[model samples]
Target: MTESGTLYVVATPIGNLGDITQRAISTLQLVDAIAAEDTRHTVGLLRHLGISKPLLAVHEHNEQQSAQGLIKRLQAGESIALVTDAGTPAVSDPGALVVQGVRQAGLAVVPIPGVSAVITALSAAGIVQPGFYFEGFLPASGSQRRKRLEILKTLPTTLVFYEAPHRIVECVTDLAAVLGGHRQLTLARELTKTFETIHTCGLAEAVAWLQADPNQQRGEFVLLVHADVQEKAEGLDDETLRILQRLLQELPLKQAVALATDITGQKKNELYEAALAFKAANTHE
Candidate 1:
């Protein structure tokens, strides 16, 4: 029987092929096989590096089943490398299951870290960085997304999120509306690659900036929103304000304020006044 081999969780460059670490390259070359989120993408990277090896498709959809097979290979002394199309694996990507399986099977799992969008954007964002929160990608649905943002609104740490091109504008719009227009934010698009753009501005101006240039809407994105600096209006967050405004559309002003107070724990009178302003401004819009 063959002895078990180590499973290496390798990090690839998010962009700029030259950014790939020497250790990652050497590990990939030495491994028996690579379990990739996308086999075709990994194939291209391997071709560029002039290193050919077996590729296994281990993406989100088939991860659980694929991990079992990968575990078997590892147990048979076939050292395997885990890679995603970009950046690190098992981080808003595939490979965690396989790593866990390998460990559970009494095989070693080693991390070969390099570039990550969360750290890449944070290093350049210029925001006060005692600490930060990585929320990854928010939920696609508006209400669900807002709820998640609500939970994040009160955190004192900077918030980081990964978003795709198609939904970026909408995501920024929701961020501006739910997080307060004046809150600071940084948008890092296509990091470490050609045409890379990183800009920090107020949430209010973010929508216009994104819309001003059509090209801004293209490519992968990492968004960093600054932490809440001070308590907002009537001690109510932008999320509670949003809910109060929505409630006003169907309920009486008093009733809306009551519900908002109950849901958000703000003073009812303050909520009533805020709800009135929200209704009047939205009406003008």
Candidate 2:
């Protein structure tokens, strides 16, 4: 039996075609076939690179079905390169299922790292937070999105998210409401493109800024929210801190803070803030 061939998870340029890596180019040249999230889109990239190969559709709609066929090809000793419309594959994009299938089949899967919107934005975001949670794209529905943000609001680390141009205004508005208007938000749009823009301001002001200039809402977006900086429990008495911590272990943050507030006569908001700091410190440990 012939040995299975490798699958290359190639990372393509998010915007500037010039960002394409030389190694990625060489891999594309050598792969037996290229599996793309969007054939039409990948074809354009291939055309620009002056390389040609058999293109197969492996987009979000048909990823699972396509993955089976890809595995068959690998088993038949045919190498395949996986790519998305832009940026790294399988990262808030299609191609993850294909990679998972190939791995389950015991075929070699390699990464051809290149430009990523998240990293590209972070490189210029100037955020000093020690870590960040990449919450790619939020729910499209306003209610669902708000609930997600509420859950994430208390996280002490930076929160990163991607938003579409049309939903940018609404998304920011929700961020301001759920996460708080005072939080700093860095908006990175159209990275590596001619109309690229990176602006940072309070979440409350983001909607106004985007609305004032229609052009700002155009293109892709990467939003980085500053880390939550609530005060620790140092100001509270030892007994209050102890009660809050114990309650947190047994209840949801809201319920725990509420109960702690009632029991200790401490302010609810203060207890909530202290709870967040406690969770953040424990999360790392």
Candidate 3:
């Protein structure tokens, strides 16, 4: 009777091939078969590392069927390694179903952790705290994206998201609209690759900076928006107070306060009282 084999979930480098761990290399070399999101892409990496093994396609379209086959191979004492094009397998990628299926079949599933774009971005974000909520890849549509942003806006911990090149501009625009220009964000572009840029700036500045350079939108993006802040009574800066005052001119008091709250990420009651006070003081003047 053949002893059942282990299922190894390996992490590959996101960009620089050198980022791959030695254990990952050994696992790939020693495994009976390799299940990959894209066999062609993984082949290039294996060749670069001078390691060759059987490659199986297990992408989004056929992950379920592929997982079943991989499980059978495991049961038959063939050790398997699951890998994505980059980063950890099954992380905003594929392999979750396979991992679950393997464990359910009483097979061992081991992790080989390495570079993650989300963590890579957050580490340099200067976010002070260790807490974060990773919301990988926002919805494609404008309306759906905005709806998702609104729900995430009030979270107290830092928020992270992955975005593609084409949608980055609109994603940043929607972020500014829903979460306000006052909030700070860290934009990490083309991480670990040449021309990589990681910039921390206010939302408004980040938008303007990207708009100023077409090249800035060309690569992968990981956006890290700072957490919601609870400010003191007089925390509204002169610029914010000015915007609130301007909004009051064309909007109803309630509407103006709500807009101010969205724009500043400040408490609604605090903004309302301030708006009322500003209005009353102006009336006297």
Candidate 4:
């Protein structure tokens, strides 16, 4: 910081208190003042850690006003820390304005990073990572939320979204219809909590399981939707199976298998069976 005041961005736990990092603890202990998205929630966290500091609420409604006060605190050489109720601050969370405004005032913004639910969920998902789209919380409204899902339908990459516990079942149903039932999907719930559950299934089954358990309707959620079976492989028939094996003679096995199965809804096993039979027939001739 130009004048010796600095703002630290602290990450709190999503559910379990033990997830907080030692560096975050030290930073919070060191800061002169703290800005929180919710004072009551932050108070509980501080109480858990036995920390007492001046806290100012800096939520979405009054970010502009809060920015001015936090800047003043920094100007007066009071070190400040920003935190959200859960996860790292400013990632679809509060602390954006505080972090941004402090940097504009020529103050240093230090990030005290810890467990993030998004990253936490992704790590457990078995999908191979190339690039993923993080769609943090869908629009709460029906039409708008489905529309948002619709827009993401064409994206050919692993997709992630944050969901409220109550609306997740409905969201999955919509996802099943729009994204199709066959897509591989993963759902994570109440992460790091005692009843933490992660399940990978076809989209339709995930909806059914959520419906069966009344308790599943509670807690934080993260969902991963794998890309749909791809446009080139959209529809195929059994008649094309033989031609596919012939084409595979000069092509790599994986690409040939993808195209062959894409053109014929035949099980990969059945296609491979036909391929073996074709090879034997050609060898015998």
Best by TM-score: 3
lDDT at residue 252 of model 1 (Cα atoms): 80
Per-residue lDDT for 279 in model 2? 61
Order of candidate numbers by lDDT, starting with the best: 2, 3, 1, 4
How many clashing pairs per prediction, in order? 0, 0, 0, 1
Candidate 1 lDDT tens digits, 206-228: 98999999999999999998765
lDDT of 4 at 29: 84
> What C-alpha lDDT do the candidate models reach, one value each?
0.83, 0.86, 0.83, 0.77
Highest lDDT against the true fold, candidate: 2
Quote the positional error of residue 1 for candidate 4 in Å. 13
TM-score of 1: 0.80
Give the CA lDDT, 0 to 100, for residue 214 in model 2: 98
Candidate 4 backbone collisions, by pair:
236-263
Clashes of 3: 0
TM-score of each: 0.80, 0.81, 0.81, 0.81
lDDT measured at residue 49 in model 2 versus the true structure, 0 to 100: 91
